[model samples]
Target: MLPRIFVVVLDGLTAMHPSPRIDRLYLAGTLVATSLLTACAVGPDFTRPTPPTATRYSPESRPDHAAPTMAGDAPSQTLRIGDRISAQWWEQFRSPDLDRLVRRSFQANPTIDAAVASLRQARYNTTAQEGFFFPTIQASYAPSRTKLSGNTGGNSPGIQGNGSVISTVSNTPASQGGTAPFNEAVIYNWHSATLTVGYVPDVFGANRRLVESLQAQSEFQGYQLEAAYLTLASNVVAAAIQEASTRDQIRTVQALIDSSERALKVLREQFRLGYAMRIDVAAQELALAQAQQSLPPLEKQLEQTRDLIRVLAGTTPDQDLNEHFTMASLTLPAELPLSLPSELVSQRPDILSAEAQLHAASAQVGVAIAARIPQFSINSTLGGNASEFSQMFWPSGKLFSLTGNVAQTLFDGGTLKARQRAAEEGLNQAQAMYRSTVLTAFQNVADTLHAIHADAHTHAAAERAVTAARVSFELTEQQYRLGYVSYLTLLTAEQNYQQARLSLIQAQASRLGDSVALFQALGGGWWNRGREQRAEAAPK
Candidate 1:
């Protein structure tokens, strides 16, 4: 294919000359010779590795649907195998604030910008490498003035006293009383214009293999960019979930503190009336202090989480976001998409990127093999030279030359063979890395599946505990007011309710977070990113 293009280019260059027939025949012969030389490439071609044949990600049997929990109307998630995930999978949470934050991060994040720049750089480098397939044509003009010394042996038309031709050469210096030659120190302008064309035929396909390697590198960078997008979106979702969980925790602690303060006021009134001991008031005071102590850490955590979200959205810490998340605001998706093991290799960007690296390494081996063989090149120049610029293009001053060269290294101390071995080793390394990435991806899915299953049951149990604790605390408080139960028993019931509430909140948040991880591990639906979205993301 490349040879046909080269032939057309050579034909075009020949067309610029006056003798169309002879020039066409000359270029045709040259093209035939070079095309025969580039017939075969020297090394291994790359093939994609086979996908794993396993049907499921985990060794142990897992339930398709997680146990139903009391959080958010008892929403239970079922694994829908072979379902198509949306490109914007984060929207499954049904939070408009989260959707806006993710979209904004895609536009503003520095990591994403860097990845896009890298992809463009790789594409440009590949284009530069492809230019080697054609010949290099250059046009140059040089005009200069030069003078010749008198002592050199030369002759010119000159007048002599005895009608003999005079010589323009002298052995004696002009300062030594000798007559200066007529042409001595004479200056003249020399003008030359040349069009040179050079081509190194891909005799062993070295240039072809080099171009193939660069193309594979560009493909690798493209996958890297996709991976960056997937990572950023996942991070934003997880961070928002964290913020909601912390806020809930802080709110729970504050409610507990207020209840404790009211109980302490009743104990002080009883002690002033001599109906309660001083120890009872001190114990209530300690419980109130403990509840207050928990609030500061939760507040600190909320502030730090807010800062992280700001940075993820590509803004400074002082720049606050208009959107905020709460447990009530985010919905738990009821259906989660699950991909088969066979499709994982094709879906994951890290795996694809690794495969591209292996391809480049394979092409490098071809380049090294070609290096051990002979290289061929042809150069031609058509131009004219004259003493005056006006006559530079005249037929009398025409110049033409065609040269062909062949080069082969006699010996290089086995350097070429060593490089070939190194390239093969690199191929081996990339293959191993690809396998490792596949294993890690499978592990991620398996772990998230296990977490989703366990989190549902944990949240359900916490809900039951909170219900019992709330009933027990209410009964104990009424009994203490009626003088039928001690103050210590009421305090213990309240403490149990506080712990149960916090546990329920954490369990609920885990379910949401693990759902996001499952989507990320399944490749985040990057392949489904449609043409419209791509066009929107492209540089204007």
Candidate 2:
């Protein structure tokens, strides 16, 4: 056995004494007993909080129907309940650019790096504190030149010859000297080398509770790291999708501006020839300006979004992160996992993190309770002291001491009891927070589930609108070419097609984003990846 460090305080004993051999045996026995007793800690042990009793995420579950859209690349998605999520969930999108960007972000995001560092630091602290379970050993050497005390308290040290071990003048205080220890008759140099050992027995489990709290904190950091990973990946995906949608919108708006320009040219000619009114020509100009105005802002947003993606991937805004993404390139997975409500409790990082806080708080309560009880400690110093440095380790200079201590607070201003109560309250707060986190997680999943269901129908309607608008615009344009339709009728057709096309892109993007949100709400499958995988998931 790796020397178990747990020690138990024997209660109700004011003092005890034993020989060194017996002391060793007693300590060994106590260590073994305490190790067994500590199988139960002072406070309530942490049980993984039970998942909500509800069976479904939402009040009314809808079937995920496959509805085809304008783009063939985005396949219809279906919900797969109680299915496992892969560690590399982003790969389901099947976009090389998204895959590469997410991979890079895992390596480069500053928030992820910071969280990783914090987790490492917490692990170190917990590991370092394990030593507290064992006795503390320290070695010391102190050599000092000091005047001899009168002797024992009142007796003289006694006279000595020139070569005596006491010293040449190891006698009493001078006949006319000052009183007591301050009036030393001789001075000598003593070199002492001692090894000391000390331990505070954990009779009430205070030390164990402390270690438990630290362990919970470390676990909390681990979940926090997971949360950072989920947030960064989702953000990168959202920004990429938004950028692609805006690019498509810009193209559509530019085409509208071109159409407006053609109408304006025809109107100007007609106005000069006394066929079209100046008011009609002015309206065409205004329409063209409005279309032109839409392009710059979309262009600006796209550029800023691309820069944001680079930053998320841990690159400077100017760095060439070569990944280029578009809606067409992203493949919507046919099947998406919808975890059971119970599973989400284990999966979500924030909820798990809150649970960890609750664990820590519970342990703190135990520690507080232990503090109000009696404490026991033991220490020993074994070494040699000599008047001459060279004789420090000699038999004549040998010295040793052992001490055992017990302390109990008979009376106080109720401070310790108050702290114990405060710790209990903290536990309650943590419990409440954990519940709230779980509720919010369920809400997120419900919202995303609804969005995904509603988006399929919405995308279906948009596809039909685009198809109808396309047919109408083409016929109207041909009629205008043949001088059978007025400019206003052509303008309306153009606007209808543009509006339908843009709405389809928005719906398509919304569906994709909703998929991302569902993954996020379900904890992003961090458990599928081990700690090492998560810590290094980003681009190397």
The candidate that wins on lDDT is: 1
Residues 7-54, candidate 2, lDDT per residue (tens digit)?
A: 222210112222334455565575566456545557677776777897
Q: Indicate the TM-score of model 1.
A: 0.86
Query: What would you estimate as the lDDT of candidate 1?
Result: 0.82
Worst 10 residues of 1 by lDDT: 65-74
For candidate 1, write residues 1-540 as lDDT tens digits.
Answer: 435544655554564445544465666676677778787899998898888987886665654433232343246777888888788999899999999999999999999999999999999999998888788888899998766455443633233222443344444556776675433543455678998878888888898899999999999999999999999999999999999999989888887887788778878988999988999899889989998998998899889989999999999999999989888888889888888888878888888898899899989999999998998898877787677677666655666666779899989999988998998898889889888988888888888877887787777777788888889999998999999987756866887798889988898899999999999888889888895488779999
